[model samples]
Target: MMIRDVKDMVKMYKLLIRFSIRSRMQYRFNFWTGSFIAAFIAFMEFALLAVILSRFGTIQGWSIAESAYLYSVLTLSKSIYRTFASDVHHLEQYLVSGNLDGLLLRPLPVLLVLMTQNVSIRFGELLLGFGMLAYSLGILAGKGQIELWSAIPLTLLISLNGALLLFGIALATAATGFWLTRISMLQNLTEDATHTAIRYPLTIFPGWLKGVLTIGLPVAFVNYMPALYIVRGEAGPWILALSAAASAAVVGAGALLWRTGMSRYQSTGS
Candidate 1:
């Protein structure tokens, strides 16, 4: 049954991709323009980091180049997740119109269904962001900044961590629609908080604040902690262990939140 459900979810997404392509084609200019703007904004963020690093020499002992390397990995993860989970990321409309009824009729998990319903085809943006990160990582490697080859696995692990963490946050926000039909603000809040952690080294913050960001929210640990271990040598073996445990805990908790929300769900009036 689970396997079958997964297949159905894949099929649903294929259909949605077709539909979204057609829909987007109708407004090609807007789509392309929006894609360009988004890509530019993402790029500028890294540029800003570069500028700051040039003047300040280092951010809590993390050089500008090192920060860029970390940011690139974080951005890559975020852009990839956003591209695939665009629908789940913008689920308030489904809840508000009681459109979720249609999804519930399917055998697949509701979250998977939501994920497939909308896809971001901004491959241009994704490519550009990834390119910048790749270039940065190469520079870090050439400068003897990072140890041989471990960077790739570490980057992949943290990217997975960030994806799980963000998905959990989105799920929690979507769950809130059970009680409050409107959730645009909640989504914004989550994104804002996430970007904050992604943009800076977690160690720059105070100890208590760091604890909250690392554990309470767990966003910092996604990129910052791991990067520290690799880039700065501050990460002990125990810290690496804690990072994995923390990510798993968030995933488990987010699943529970979604399950609880589903039980309380009262479909919006049609």
Candidate 2:
């Protein structure tokens, strides 16, 4: 039975992928424009940051290359989440318009269906992130701060965990739509705040803000800790362990919240 269910899931996933691809292809211009705009925005952000850092030399003792590494990790993680879980980011629409009812009636899990609803055209962001990561790694390797071969694997692991952390946050926020019916403002505020906080080294922030980011929201573990260890070559084992634990805890809490929210959902009659 377990094997059969796994096969069914694979089949459903393939079907969803096919439909999503075809739908996107039907609007090729929109897809291209959206991707270009996203990439341009990311480029401008990095350019502005680079200009400021060039004037000041460093922030909180972090060099431009180190800051680039941190930004790459955060950007890559967010791009991955947006690509795979874009529907979850817009889950309020389903809740508000009664579309969630159709998803609930499917044999597969509603979460699975929601996640696969769209394939985001964020490839430009992904490409930019990889470029930044590669450039930063080269700089770090030249400075003898990190070994490229080992750092490659470690960075990939960190990026995956960070993406999972973001997904968990998005899921928990979306789940609130069950009660609020329009949680976009909350979602935007959380995402913006997190992006702002993680774009720089955590040490620059106040002790209280760092504590909140580490304990309350826990976004610090998503990128800052791993980046700190990678660039500084300190606390390697402890950072990895803590990051893993934090990712697990955040994702588990999000899943539990989502289940609870689903139980409270009262679908609109539309």
| Candidate achieving the largest lDDT | 2
Candidate 1: which stretches are off by over 4 Å? 1-26, 236-241
TM-score (C-alpha) between model 2 and the true structure: 0.95
Any runs in candidate 2 off by more than 4 Å, and if so which?
A: 1-11
TM-scores of all predicted structures: 0.86, 0.95
The residue-level lDDT of candidate 1 at 33 comes to 82
- Report model 1's TM-score to 2 decimal places: 0.86
Q: Count the backbone clashes (under 3 Å) in each candidate.
A: 0, 0
Question: Residue 73 of candidate 1: its Cα lDDT?
Answer: 63
lDDT of 1 by residue, 1-270 (tens): 999977876787788777876877788898888888888887887778788889998988877767876776677667767767778767778877888899899876787767766566766657765686678677778888776588777777777777667666667777777778788887777666666666788767889977777767777766777777776677665666677777678768877887888888788665
Native-referenced Cα lDDT, model 2 = 0.88
